[model samples]
Target: MDMEYLKQFSLDGKVALVTGAAYGIGFAIAKAYAKAGAKIAFNCRGEKHMEEALAAYKAEGIEAKGYYCDVTKEDEVQKMVADIEKELGTIDILVNNAGIIKRIPMLEMSAEDFRQVVDIDLNAPFIVSKAVIPGMLKKGHGKIINICSMMSELGRETVSAYAAAKGGLKMLTRNICSEYGNANIQCNGIGPGYIATPQTAPLRTPGHPFNEFILAKTPANRWGTTEDLEGPAIFLASDASNFVNGHILYVDGGILAYIGKQP
Candidate 1:
């Protein structure tokens, strides 16, 4: 690789916008991008939490600002992206990390619940990508990383809606890659294993069957930490992955590979 190839992995002077950046995986992604020298336009639903994330980033001496956007709302998302570009310049790196995962029985899930999952999980990436693509095309380069889930490929009993949405996200990532690859836009998906997010705290209790089952299924024998995701996030968002398009990179601690057969 040439010197330029090495610099491609450096995101200095790049502008990144990460949604759901208040906490969890999204927060981790934003930090990773910032650490890679990209300025951040972090998105959160409200002001206070947004302030917290921005403050934290500033403490790292990274250029970062927060925007408020309810991703499920079309107008809000469009306006938010527009404002980010206006204020932060061209969005060179866009991480579609904001997603919601719910555990509800298939039969018990309402039409509204299913729609909500689709809106947040599958549709939000499309919305943000749609808003960011033109600028990227104009610049002739951009990177988009969608936070898909292991459920994108596998189905579980209570998470049918989440599974469907994540599955759709994986396909959506590839579809966008196909449509925009010639435009120098790289789109990819990241599938994380069962992570120890606040949303999954209930399962973190001792002897929680949910936690134990996930651990047993995963070859790494541990719950996924947000810290486990930083490096992949940086690589995908940086020029390091310039030729990597439509790839579904699983950071699953070997869960996807094991297939859960008791040996």
Candidate 2:
């Protein structure tokens, strides 16, 4: 047991920026990162959720702040990154967790729906990542965790576009690591399973067959919680994952390995 080799899990004095931090997995990750001793810049849709997250962090006795960053907007995203670096100091890590998905069937899904999902989920990561890279490069070290999805590797009938976007995100992450690994920057992704969140609550409703199928497929025999991802998030954000670059770490509940369909 080498003592000095074990300090990579600590994130003291680092700064992190997490998008979609108002609630759900993003919020949980932000709070956990703060608890691990990182100054946080949590972003949401509006000022209210940002303030609420900030206040909660204050209660936890950790340094946290709020910012308005619409990941879809290039200019706004750029300004937010700059503002975060200037106000909160350099952003040592970034979590691209802001995304949305529409559940309509492909034939019935509108063009706008597909575009919106791709824009926010996939395109925004590209925009925001670009905005933050220069800062990371200048500082000579940074970590990026793009919130991917199980859909990145698996496909569903009604969610073709969502799957496509996430798949693209997977390659994008690898490409980023390939191009920037030499610069001391690490880029990876977190593909969460069926987490119980406000956004995912609809997936687990009364008379919903999806829920039953999901549980049966997962070896854990239950849905995951947002809290389940906090440990992995902290590890990725900290120095623990310094050698872990261009990887898609699946936090799924073994559903990915299940070969049998639900009976």
Candidate 3:
């Protein structure tokens, strides 16, 4: 392998702003960026989560800055981005990883509940991306990675709102690429499969029906880990994927491709 070719993967000295990185997938990606030599900046809506996230980064020997901001609010997102530019330099990469999911059957889900999910999952990405694009244009290149989901493509019971929001997010990712590719900004998404996180621990418990269902559906016969997503995230955010635009890299343990064995 050519060592020179591998240099494209290095994120040395780049500034990365990963939203909702206080924990879980966002945290994993932020940690990976720090390891890959990027300056890490993350946002949390709550002060408690911000404190914990900073401490966690410290424990990992990473010098990360955490901000308190509500991504769904455009003013707050803009302010946070401005602060990041001042403190960390122009953001070279952005991960719209902040989101929420509310599982409720469509018929029973109230309009308020639906709007709340859409506001966080779909609209906030728009607000945050908008805030950072100008800086990216000034810097000459940028990468925007949206944290999509399996629901982006498939619709299941009790997730009408989530599916709708993610589907919209998928289109938003493409639209961003269409609008910004000429400016050297690559906008893409990562659709995660069943990951074993705290929120899903109950479903992942041995002998749980949902667990068996997911295992049967996924060709890998297992759940995905946050670690499984790090490489793809880095690839999209680094120089390596400069030409790869408007794409959704599904890190789903093959669930999206498998049809499952016959009952």
Candidate number achieving the greatest lDDT relative to the actual structure? 3
lDDT of 1 by residue, 1-263 (tens): 58776776688888998888877888788888777788888778877887788777778676778888888788998898889888989899888888776778988889898899889998888998899998999999999999999989998888988899999999999999999999989999899887888878998887988788888898998888998999888888887788999999999999888868575
- RMSD to true structure for each model, in Å: 2.2, 2.1, 1.0
TM-score, model 1 to reference: 0.92
TM-score of each: 0.92, 0.92, 0.98
* Clashes (N, CA, C under 3 Å) per candidate: 0, 0, 0
- Model 3, total clashes: 0
Best of the two (1, 2) by lDDT? 2
Q: What residue runs in model 1 are displaced by over 4 Å at the alpha carbon? A: 1-6, 59-61, 198-202, 261-263
Which scores better on TM-score, 2 or 3? 3
lDDT string for model 3 (1-263, tens) is 89898889999999999999999999999999999999999998888888899999999999999988999999999999999999999999999999988878899999999999999999999999999999999989999999999999999999988999999999999999999999999999999988889989989988999899988999999999999999999999999998999999999988888789799
Question: Over all chains combined, what TM-score does candidate 2 have?
Answer: 0.92
Candidate 2 least-lDDT 10 residues: 254-263
